[model samples]
Target: MMNITIKRIIIGICTTIILLTIYLLVPQVSNPSPSYETKLTHGTPVSDDIRAMLTPSIEPKRTRAIMVMQDGKVIYEYGPTDKIMNGHSTRKAMLSLLYGIAVDKKLINLDKTLSELDIDEYIPLTTQEKSATIRDLLMGKSSIYLPASGEHDNQITQRPKRESHKPGTYFFNNNFDANALGTIFIKETETSIGEFMEEYLAKPLGLQDFDSDNVIMGSPWFMPKKKTMHEQYYIYISTRDFARIGSMVANKGRWNGKQIISEDWIIKSTSSHSDLSNNHINYGRYDGFGYQWWTASDTNTIWTDGYGERFMIIDPDKRLTLVEQNFTGNSLLSSGLWLMNKNMDSGLSNLMKAHKTLAKNK
Candidate 1:
């Protein structure tokens, strides 16, 4: 009995140490310390109808954070904009921004194929799959479709048979495309995503709540059971920081009297290169796809969204940006979805009402 107890204690200690080591290996970030409201400056106030949308929902159904900006000023905010959360697939849009800069610097060529870059996956890429170009990946038309690191069941199941369609011929959003793009970015720029993000975005934009701790050099994470050759470089940004990014995008990639990315790149990146109409998507939500951004089904507005309601919506014509973040405190799918979406629509509409600077022709 004594020997068994001793062994059990030793095993428990070893298990705890192993868990700690794994946790340390992967990057982790947290909410603000001494958490305070992220309301920096209030822009033009809105009417009561719009104010109602900015108000938080009841209890666990409420969102964690949201911010709206018009013409580089914060019009309103709800919850702690300083709160940090996984931007999830929204990182794809962020990568789009970086790619714009990289392309401007002649660091990468969109037409460059995976074959030319020598890109590969754990499951191995067929010669046909390797023919997909960086442009195809950005447009989510790779159609290479193999199980990737961040794939969920739906993604894996939705994948058409490999090589079912030629590169840039069909549109299918897959992790392999985004993850491989991350690898290609690192290889071409010879800079870690985190470092480049800091130098190009956070510092230049004067982001208040930017944190670099969760910036990993590889895929968002690694799993022993699931192996993938490409690593996903996830960007962890705050709601406020997201608004800055959206605003920059809305401003044609210009910030603070400086051209961060060429106007041409921004136009190309946000334009609907891939039309989703008549696609098999049952949801039938999005109308079109740009490099990484999604277009509103009814409006020309550009937006990017991630899991758990992390969203950044941009309307260059109106010069408006709206950002929201939630740590799954509640979901739009929950019973409260209608209410949340209603408020979101109202808030965004009011923000756009504040400034209607008609965008020039793209």
Candidate 2:
């Protein structure tokens, strides 16, 4: 009888284990993860006057989403804010945040040379490339001139010849610098960038949308050059979550009183490290480059612009963050670069107008 009871108990335990495994494997459709609170009580609604100013700049079908957060509350949002969209070069800013955290933890040394990291793939690095430091890459001054795939027309046209300028002296807006940095980050952290982001950033910030699965490796234009090593590689995240990133920057790397990243790193990464006045490619409104973010010539606002006019703008003085995602089609040519630039410029201008209007009404 005792032997029979033991067998029954074992069978019961095994069934329970199988049932638990199935339950965990199935997607949880009912109890979804928590996201940022609206907190509409804290801020005034976006006035109709401001909406009129913004609507002209944003095309409903072409523009995926736009979100505005002021003083830690959602003040305005338009379009499908919950939709996941690709963040092109804007992913560079996200990578910059990870670098800051790694630096703070002593996991990565900014002064480390590329040669020391043993980061070589597809094409071997030249001697000059090896000498570039991590800091140089962060500043977009890594004078390792190489033909980076999927680069903008301006970047390709303006790229300096190999060995023309010493590392840390010239700025080229080279995607190779950013891609190489991603490789180095992986070498130092022993974690994929996407996994690291999910564990350290997304979960901690209470972001509703972001996962390892959403992290795309390489651009289709550049195959065989390691996805993680593609500077043009992207992360697909919701506009609201993207705004949270800008909000963190505006708050000096703090989220809800917790220091997600060091305040010093935030200052250093957002401040103008390279003047772009003479850069061959005119970013139009932007005149300076920080670690990976862009800075306006006259304002404290720091921003990141993705291809096709996707942008995340952070204004520290005003304690405001805005994210706009315009994902229309595969080719950016559909919108044309000129129109894209104009759209971004107008969007930003109208956002400022909205802010002023809200403040005036209050």
Candidate 3:
């Protein structure tokens, strides 16, 4: 009788485990969300063959990815776009969009001097560095000079003497170049950069999943106590999700009939408002800079650049957009000449030609 009782208990436990496993493994089916059509302007046309033309070039690059959204529709998408790829200064452009939202909500005034706030408390530096304004930082002309290049290359050295280029005159991406600005946002809003970003931009834009996975609680690179920012590479976003961001910008910060960011800030941030005309940051592209965004040679072309050849290209004039994400290599260690760096030029050239053809047809 004792043996039988023990056997019964074991069988019961095993049966329960099997039941749970089946419940977990079996897929649950539910009503799918309603599909929505992309809004295309009447008579507007994008070349039907653009994706076909671009695909042949993509495979040879090995790690290349591409996605095109015409008038808010995923006309084409390919490769590891949903992968958590490293974003270098492309993040800087996204941060610029968030800054615009902060400005719209009166959290921080673009003209407000950084010295007026407790920016010094968060980032250690002299009054000169602290004197930089939000506008200066956005314009990439803040005199806050630091010796760093590319992503994760945070080697900052204060110039013994400030340069004569004058504030709001040059462009640099030193980590110290953006550090004080983050501190400025914190001081003005009584919150960290990441928190302010979520409250103002992500939530409104339906981007809760951005920092949901692989969160780094507080920033690992900066002063630890601030707890204002987090630094994790695993921002889980798909090509379409990223294209949605570009669409919002192309629509003047309006997302699905809602204003996610102020239209005025959108114009200022994407325009060629910088003094540095047609400057090349990576290799052989003469794109202009505005705030943190890059203005393409074409008046209507604007983009936010990311590391590993990731790009969110927006052309409002043509009512078209494209977002591509790939894991190429760190620019600093990129062996000087990688195929990925050249990918944009060839891709954009094809895209531009396609756009022109479509325009002519219309």
Highest lDDT scorer: 2
TM-score of each: 0.81, 0.79, 0.68
* Cα RMSD, each candidate: 6.2, 10.5, 9.1
What candidate 2 gets wrong by more than 4 Å, as runs, is: 1-42, 56-59, 219-232, 329-349, 352-362
Q: Summing lDDT over every window of 10 consecutive residues in candidate 2, give the lowest-scoring window.
A: 24-33
Q: Report lDDT per candidate.
A: 0.73, 0.74, 0.58
Tens digits of lDDT, candidate 2, 1-362: 99999999999999999876664444211122445333222366566776676565535535567788876677778887766666778888999999998888899999988888776545677888888899999999988777675577777777778888899887788888877777788889998888888777887777776676656556433126533344545677778888887888888988877889999999999998887888766778788889988898565678898876687778887778877787533333432343554543326566666655654554
Model 1, runs deviating above 4 Å: 1-27, 30-41, 217-225, 328-362
Residue lDDT tens for model 1, 1-362: 99999999999999999887665443355543322223345568544555564564453344467777777787777787776666878999999998998888899999999999999887888988999999999999998888776677467777788889999998887888888889999899998887787677766777676645445555333335357778767677778878888988889988777888789999999998877876666424578898988987465688888765566778888778877776532121331353355432223343334323322311
Task: Spell out the clash pairs found in candidate 3.
Answer: 88-307, 90-305
Off by over 4 Å in 3: 1-48, 57-63, 120-126, 148-161, 192-195, 207-209, 212-236, 278-284, 297-299, 328-362
lDDT of 3 at 357: 57
**Candidate 3: Cα lDDT at 110:** 87
- Which residue pairs does candidate 1 place in steric collision? 219-231, 219-232
